[model samples]
Target: MGKSKVYFTNMHATIKENLPQKLRRLIKTAGIGQIDFDRKFTAIKIHFGEPGNLAYLRPNYAKTVADVVKELGGKPFLTDCNTLYVGGRKNALDHLSSAYVNGFSLLSTGCHIIIADGLKGTDEALVPVKNGEYVKEAKIGQAVMDADVFISLSHFKGHESTGFGGTLKNIGMGCGSRAGKMEMHSSGKPHVSHSKCVGCGTCIKNCAHDAITLKDHKATIDHNKCVGCGRCIGVCPMDAVQPASDESNDILNKKIAEYSAAVLYGRPNFHISLVIDVSPYCDCHSENDIPIVPDVGMFASFDPVALDVACADAVNRQSVIKGSILEKNGHKHQDYFTDVSPETNWRVAIDHAVKLNLGNKEYELITI
Candidate 1:
């Protein structure tokens, strides 16, 4: 429970060593080799840029992580769960297609991609969260739980909801099953966006609980019968079924911490976050805006919580980019994430994560 070690390396690279080589060295020095990866299935969780979000970490970073795993005699594969929203990554087929379109092919990343939540986002494993107040059981992607070792290659950036999407966000929300994401973001049920609903019977056909019925060529969800499994939200062709994002920002952060506990508890896990392209919104968005701050560098740690804090500190230390949202917001809160996103306080997640015994908030930032 002392100050955890967070190793960092700046973005300055020379002809002798490129960025990827630098990343490899950073992770190695961060004690990634301490894990016993001999013939184990290692899951390198990452976001494959939402098709057009150029701010997402490039596949080269993933290749570096995967190659290190392979060199350690581990079977490594890049994995991410299907998104809850209707997007290019709502199902396994579309998800894989989007990943390929974003240049994450095995040919490019030197590893295969697995949509952890399966075709319809129902392939899940129920995991119990220890000392959890917000969530007792976390519905996680089955493939993620099946892995023997876990590694997060995250793009540390701004988020509209939780402030910053870092290591915990990548593991908790990114690895969540469709239903898991629902539990974190909402009251566990989806409502039909009447304007967007074409009365497409897709949700009706896919609802196992028969909670959906078409009325006047529009889908109406029967809250009484709804199980809050969030299948309707995923299968809606027009993206008509929407999550009721009613959870408070603080509660949302706590739920993320609990979900993260479900994934990392009793497991060998490592984390790496790239503090470049500090966009003001999540990579889940199809488009990315200009970075709010200059690219800091890369960070690695055994402690996901500490890694996140270190990254946030590094970002806050840098001057805001001119014309960026952070500058426009005027730094009223003196915190970059909250300044960019006034409604969200990223520290809620950090404090909740610390309370959950995830890792120490205090960290020694070691620049290499």
Candidate 2:
């Protein structure tokens, strides 16, 4: 495959052109208009800031993307699926509340917000993965799969498990339903934490496979009957049920690539990643640490893989911020992400995504 085109524009703004206007120019120059979006439901996948995390992309940027989609005759909506871990966004009602708290209302973004997975994070569509290694069918949010066109507007940042969360991470893990997220993060099924259990019987009532039984005033899971749908993890009031997040980082990365394939295959998709904030942890966290590096710029591409690679390269070239996590880690490895998160290898996702024919690793950065 040939080198894919990745458009870039530095954060520097002039008096004549503001940041939002610049983002509009950047994505349009990156060939966003090439897609046919006439009267189609275009899903602008985004991360609404988790309550108290200030590093997430502002709603103004989402409005810029939505405006461009409207100009192309698409019906646009901002969206994201419920998270697997316990947080402010575990379910739709709380998810919308968090988004509203972060200023993502229809008035701000010029688009409605859709929690891709339904009320309890169970509404999903099973999509069969072609040439899949680990997953046979990927469970994705029903609303994401129902869209005619998909666009990822992601905040590029560090993650404890996956090094840096970029386009692939945004689309793959972010689009997953509760069960799909469970499958990517764990090789084993969830287990009950006996010490934390209050015998509330919530897990027993929620388990569809008859996997739970209360004994000695605590809950126990029958592994033989458990299908690992992850509903118990969400419904437990005491937070006693725990997902075994024991998957190796490499395997977790590859699984993310497969899930991304499930989301983007046979669809018109565009990707944009903002390499700002450079936080040392995911936006899923309620708080964000100081940025590890100076803000780079905004990037857009038709190819998710190349877009991520370009973003990673841009981040690696910056000087580490004093007192940030990267500086404290002492840059042990050549890669800044690895130096920050020694256990993770972000390349695994990029390699697997290439093998899946998502996009070429080689890219031509077009400065607009």
Candidate 3:
């Protein structure tokens, strides 16, 4: 009902202070611990970098937040949903391996990793959002919906589609199961390319409702049986499955907002975004481009929308890296995401999320 506060701190460190302490202070000052955490199942939603992408957040930062939650008697687990596209993180085992390889280990962060979607990325809970745009309920991963509290630790970086992946992006899309992600990213149907299908039956095995079948030495999808959950896309050994149309970037962004609304329903949530690496693409890529700007520090807020807006505003104020993605246009007087991906306008997600009553767009930036 009142102005939301987004706590921030720059990369300023002197003899009397350090960045890690500053991060904890930012979380505390944002009132994340005000929620009851005793014996609660807390899900710290985060992206465990695709192995080989070195731009992800260090596990030590996760440890800091884990300590805070543990002190409050909450059972915290670092979690993320399975990917929509085929990759090393398509299933729980490979996903966990990628997570640990990326430095999110029990020894590193003092928490276990859980792929929010089940083994094949089918575990989900349909959360009904009675809104004009979304029509019905959004299907989110079961573990995320089952959690008593939600904490989104986002790596704020440039995205190919959404312009940026901030707090809302981290929770909304990041919390979705592979099918949920497919729903957000595209409107067209998903299909399995028979040419690429090796008859391996990987997709058939993973399909929850037997929507995929092998016919004439190839895999075929029965759209009637298929709920478009996207598991087949991720599990195809031959990389056969694909979304029909990539969907418009604006619709993709709006879907992301709807997914975020599903994630915030009836839960105590805290969000932290680290605007570092400043890469031009998502960490889903195996490679990361050079940083497009200096490392902006951490931000925390109870209001995910305000937190994202503050992070974007902070990134926009920085100068672009000399030879990075933003250098091509001589550092346009706008956010680097728009400069690099002109086709994408990241603000649409923020505006739409605000319209959904997720949180306010206007926020007071408090430098902690």
Candidate 4:
């Protein structure tokens, strides 16, 4: 296959012309309107940053995409799955409230919002994709599967786990329902610690699998039956549950690749990544740190894998902003995220994504 088209524009103007108009121009140039959005349910997967995380994509940008979808006669909804390791977005109710607080209200984006996973985080559909590495199927959010079209409005940034989070990250991790997340993170088990367990029964109440119990002055998970869904890890007020053992970073990266493939199997998808506020960690955190690099710009593509690769390449090319967490000063030969999180390799994710035939590793970047 030839080079994948990845269109971009720098963050030069103010939000008025810079966002809405630029989105239209970029997509039009890239032939995004050709997709059959007419009278379809279009899901625009996006991360509404946690309450204190300022690094997420702004609501105005999502509004631009939502408006464009409406113009094409699609009923657009801003969405994201309930997170696996949660601070705010563990369940649909709390997740929606977080979205509103983070400025993803219907009035802001001109569309409704839905947590892909329903109230208990167990509402999901198992899609059969017998890809070689995966045996039978991958469980994606039912609402996501029901949508006629898919779009990802990703906030491109560094992640402690993944080398950098981008369009593919937005799809693979963002579209996974709570159980899907558990499957991807299966190797890493989390158990409740009795000493820290408040015995308030919050963990038991929130657990979808009924894996946890409050008795004998503490909490216990029947590991023989524990599916390791990771919901209880986030629900404990006293921080009782934590990962039992850290899996090799390589395993985590590869799992992300496989999950990304499951999300895109049969969807008519398009993606847009905003490379702004290049934070050092995931927006799932309740707080965000200073950006390690200046805002680069925006990118759009039909290929999620290529889009992420292009964005990561763009970020790697920029010089790290001093006085931030990026401790390295060698612009000639430094990987920014790696400099910050030394144990992990982001390239593994890219290579694995390509290996799984998600998209080509070689991408040609075009500036709009």
Candidate 5:
């Protein structure tokens, strides 16, 4: 309906205040104090970059947010669900180790880390999506749904599949349990990469539905029996099991919006996105390419959709970095994200989010 307020601050720092201190001021000015956080359990949803990815938001930013929450008497913890793809963060133990390696310790962030979906990524909460078209009940991590308040501390960057990974992508796809991620990414079941499969029978053993069977030292999935729960993908040591990416980017974006609604429904939520680094691919990748554009800044909002739109607009106005992916690809679409990723359309998520009443696309940008 009406324009939501999105607060912004440039990365320029004075001698009086550094980036983290500026971040603290930004959120407070944006009215994070409006929420009564007295003794409430708060989940600060974030991506603790894949092991080698340097594009993720640093732990110092997370500490600034956590410190503010603590000032208001809230108990906050950094949380993220296990990733669907094979990486250092596929399971809880590996995920925590990666977070620590990436400088997200309790000492650094002033908050503990919780792998939302338990040890193996199977633990989940079935959350009903109101007015959902693609998903009726969203499978989110149990711990993420258990929080009294939700805050997304996102690293805004380009994504290969969903156009760009912003607040909605961080909350929707990041909060999903293994099965929930599978549902958002694909309409069908997973298949094994014949070359990578070693016939280790790991997927076969983990599949409760008996959908996977090894034939001649290679695994094959029976889609008829497979329920698409995504358990096999996590259990495969060789990373041979791959989820079908058959869902169109448009449908995938809508599904992500629905999943986000499911996570935030009836909960007090806040969002902050840092548009620095501006990588051409997701932080899920172990290797990050050069930024597509110069760093925009930090943004905070009560509305996730509006926050994303504001960040996208800010990036679109900036000049492209020389020799970066955006420059190499050329600005055919005149949109920074599309110039970097031609196949994706970030607007799909914003439109779907508006339709779901999650947030407004229109926003008033207030410089802090």
Candidate 6:
């Protein structure tokens, strides 16, 4: 495959051209206008930061993307699926509240915020993964799959699990329904944490397969009956049902690639990643640590894999920020992501994405 063109722009802004305007220029130069968005529903996928974590991309950035989509006669909405973990964004109501608290109101973004997976994180579309190894059918949020065009407005930053959350991570993991996330994170089904279970039987009511039953007032999953659809996890009121994080990091990464393919297949998709705030952990956390490196810049591409590789390369070239996690951890691997998260190998996702023909790893970085 030929090297995909990834457009880049530094943080430096002139007096006349500010950061958001520069971002608009970057995407336009990157050929986002190539897609015909006449009256189409465009899902601008983004992470509305968890309630207290300030590392997430601001609503202004989302507005820029939304405004561009509107300019092309597309109906745009900011979107993200409910998170798997217990946090501010676990369900749609809480997730919307969190987004609003974090400044992602309709007024702020110039687009409505849709919690993709519906109220309980159960609303989903079963999308078949082409040439998939780990997943045959991916469970993505219904709203995301229903979109006419998909655009990822991602915040490129450190992730504890995937090594770094970029375009693929944002699309794959972010677009997945609750069940989809459980599949990517675990090889096995979720188990009820007896300590957290209140014997409410909410899981049993929601289970379509009769896989869950109350044993001595605590819910227990019958593995034989359970299809690992992760419905029980979403319904458990006390957060008793916990997905097993047994999948190897490499396998998890590959599965994420497959999921990404499922989301973007046969669709008009564009990705933009802002490599700023460079936090040590995901925005899923309520607290964000200092950046591990200086703010890199904004990047846009039609190719998610190449976009991620270019962002990683840009981040690696920067000097580690003093007193941040990367510096404190001693940069042992010479790769900043690995130095901070030694257990994760982000290359697995890129390699699998390449094998899946999602995008080329080689890219021509064109500065705007």
Tens-digit lDDT track for model 6 on 1-368? 78999999999999999999999999999999999999999999999999889999999999999999999999999999998888999889999999999999989989999999998888999999989999999999999999999999999999988999999999999999998999999878889889999999888998899988888998899999998877777777788899888998899899999999999999899999999999999999999999999999999999999999999999999999999999899986878999889999999999999999999999999997
List of clashing residue pairs for candidate 1: none
Off by over 4 Å in 6: none
The residue-by-residue lDDT of candidate 4 on 1-368, one tens digit each, is 88888999987777567566887788777767989998999999999988888888889999998988899899999888887764778778889999988888989889999888787566787776546363246668888989999988899888887767877777877777776776665654677767777788887887767777777868888786677666676556686776554556666677677777777777688888889999988888899888888889888998777888888888888877888888453333377778777777888878888888888877888897
Cα distance off (Å), candidate 3, residue 11:
1.9
Per-prediction TM-score to the true structure, in the order listed: 0.98, 0.98, 0.95, 0.91, 0.97, 0.98
Task: Summarize candidate 1's per-residue lDDT along 17-130 as a digit string, tens digits.
Answer: 999999999999999999999999999999988987789888999999999999999999999999988678889999999999888989998989998989989999999999
Candidate ranking under lDDT, highest first, comes to 2, 5, 6, 1, 3, 4
Question: In model 3, how large is the Cα lDDT of residue 247?
Answer: 77
Candidate 6 lands at a TM-score of 0.98
Better of 3 and 4 by TM-score: 3
What digit string (tens of lDDT, one per residue) describes model 5 on residues 234-332? 888899998887899999999999999999999899999999999999999999999998899999999999999999999899998999988989997
Cα lDDT of model 2 overall? 0.95
Model 1 segments beyond 4 Å from truth?
none
> Model 5 off-target regions past 4 Å?
none
Encode model 2's per-residue lDDT on 268-315: one tens digit a residue.
Answer: 999999999999999999999999999999999999999999999999
Model 4 residue 126 distance off true place after TM-score fit, in angstroms: 1.5
Query: Candidate 3 on 1-368: residue-level lDDT in tens?
Result: 68898888887887877777777778888888798999999999989998889998889889889888998899999999988876778888899999888888889999888889988788898887747285267879999999999999999999888898788888888888877888887775699777787888887877779888889878888888888878777766678888765778888888888888888878899899998888889888888999888999899888999988888888888877888878976656466788888889988988888888999988988887
Global CA lDDT of candidate 6, please?
0.93
lDDT of 3: 0.85
Q: What is the lDDT of residue 71 in candidate 3?
A: 88
User: Clashing residue pairs, candidate 3?
Assistant: 179-229
